[model samples]
Target: MYRLMLHGGVHVLEGTFVNGAFHKPLFFFCQTTMSTETDETRQSLLLEQESRHTANQHTHTEGAKMPNRKGPSGASRLKKCIGLFFEILYWLLTLILVQFWKACTAVALSLMLTYWLWGGWATFCLMIAALIGIFYNLQDSVLYFPNEPESSRLYVPPATALGIPFEYVTITTPDKVHLSAVLFKQRAELAPGVPTIVFLHGNAGNIGHRYMNLHELYAMCGCNILAVDYRGYGKSEGVPSEEGLYVDAEAAVNYLHSRSDIDQSAIILFGRSLGGAVAVHIAAHRHNRDKLAGLILENTFTSIPDMGSVLFNLDFVRWMPLCLIKNKYFSIRKVSRIQVPTLFLSGSSDELVPPKMMQALFRICGAPSKQMARFEEGTHNETWRCRGYFSVIRQFTATVCRPGSNVMEPSPSPTPGPSLADYLGRVNMQHQDV
Candidate 1:
């Protein structure tokens, strides 16, 4: 059966037409032989349609003629105009429904949170006003959730829907857990032993959502980037845990190792968020530094406790005394052992993982080549601010991936995000001039 869709047409066919195809015409001979029961059914349908149409027209006429005269001398005409204005506004909002869902959700959630925090029905009475705010904002919430519209317009690949170029490969871990990953190769003009970078995605979402960043790295950085899905992420099999993800990472490494064309020494590990933990673990523990060229960590913390303290705004969490619990990505401990060159990047305004901790990790990394780039205004996951995301990465790849050219330089500090006062000040200044 074909789907009835909004853009295609409005199909309000009901009753008998619901299941069968109304568009299918009968052969001339078959039409002539059809029974009287069908004629009776058609007549009943036409009468129902006519009655509904007449009732709708009558309702419309009555509504058009009615007047809301609240008082004898009050501004009744003004009231009518205002009512009409709101009716038209409602219609427009209905037409553009998706854009306003987030604002609505935010207002509702805010009021709920406020009440939940405040307690008592007396203070909760203030929530009524928030319902009005929620009315407008709900539209924005809807817009954000359903397959972000802009990303939909991108060219996604077929083997997987994410649009990254791939050749299917299966890898077995040293412990023999099978894993799946897609390899994205660059159309290169480079020397034969070009560096290959394997991407380890942040914990949580899968690989499809990361194509925008991946597309840039492949096109500009010109590295053979293999973005692997951890266990239970994307199309990959098995459950995800600290140990499971590490096993997955090892499998991905061994897969790269099996390839004859890939230079073992030129392999670079690029990890984002939680992937940084895994990458640092592999780089530090596995005796493969001679075969590994470099490592890059973006928006990553030093240990889980450090990240937890940053998240909950408590320093004591970071001071936990456990052996495994001390390190965030545990990069701080491992960074000292990592002899390969490294690049660490963090956003200053990162609320989740504090930038200070990332900076601390940068200082601890004992690499012949090491650089820490700080984006002063960037939020968590926003690589866009750090030299278009691609530029800093390309520079890092060139510096660390090449054997003799172990270049490392300070990345420029990023521009700040606009403050609230700045926006209001501009508006106030404009009005004062008049």
Candidate 2:
């Protein structure tokens, strides 16, 4: 009948008085032995845990001291080397293409002119021949300015960035050249038989440069627009030439004809500057003439030879034979054959192309319906920024391209503005004063 009890953290053994002192002595011995075993087991566990912690610390310290022995793979090194080689090659080619040829031509022309000044009549004749050859070869460089402003060829900002939904398209010319283009459709559901404009830009810059104009046209006119970059411009392939540009325009129109979203019968061709020449060609040609609903020409020239006479003030350059000119746009000759509704947007203060040329084109245009909008303070490049530029275009398209619309009445004559000669005279006077 011995009983064990805990008192103040000590184990006490108690027995009834009947068992006497013998039970107490045996229970006490048993309690002491059990406490000793428990203490030993606790100490052993603490020692084992401490030893494990120390081993783990040592392992981590050793790992920290080790270094990574592996280097970049052979494939990585090869790729870097190839990239460097191509970069060097690209710069070298650029220098040769842009600077070397130009430098050589300049030196050659200087030497030839020096000889012509001091030598006999035979030398003069040879110099003339050389000049003709040089002009012929370099005409493309002077006419096509896709690289002007430097940034034009480098990057073209996307239409989507301006919140205008557009489709980036590639048009293949009949000659197998690829051209870059953008198709912008109105966000709202268009009514049946809505018109589409084939936007042809000037010689310099790509389709992206015309984003602001395109945006305004799309929003204000409420029409579908397909803006295309001609050959050798933007992302389009092949060199730019007068014939090549005409081909590019034809290809763009043909592309529209193939599309289901576009209304082929309501297609309009809108061109500015050199593009105006291209548009006139398309509108006059037998193939595309009947398919077009309207024509829009802005700040465009008459012909390459006419522009040369205006741009080059020297008597010798102005008097040069027109046959020497290689890229003759000859828009004046072509405008007489256009048989569709036409709109002429003229900048009175235009310094590049004479306003008279635009007026002449409008007068002679064979289109049954036509209108001329004159912006008095507008310049060659800034005419599109004029206050009533887009409104005039919107009005023309609305009146001309609407279904069953037969309005062929000509617009009233626009008031004449300052001529290019007057503008240039003022410029010269200002420069002389300065």
Model 1: how far residue 422 lies from native, Å: 26
Off-target runs (Cα >4 Å) in candidate 2 are 1-128, 315-319, 402-434
Note the residue pairs that clash in candidate 2.
none
Alpha-carbon lDDT of model 2:
0.75
Could you tell me how far off, in angstroms, the CA of residue 38 lies in candidate 1 after the best superposition? 66
TM-score of each: 0.54, 0.66
Give the best candidate by lDDT.
2
Model 2 lDDT per residue over 1-434, tens place:
33454433455454333324332222322333335557675577447555655665576579788977889889989999999999999999987767544523444455476775787777667667666666677877878999776877767778775566678999999999999999987544452246789999998999888887677666656677899999989888888999999999989988988887656778889999999999999999877776888999999988887787788765465456777778889888888888888888898999889999988888778887778878887798888766667667766777777574322222121223322222221110000000
Residue 416 of model 2 has an lDDT of 33
- State the displacement of the C-alpha of residue 132, model 1, in Å, after optimal TM-score superposition: 44
What overall lDDT goes with each candidate model?
0.62, 0.75
Q: What is the lDDT of residue 309 in candidate 2?
A: 72
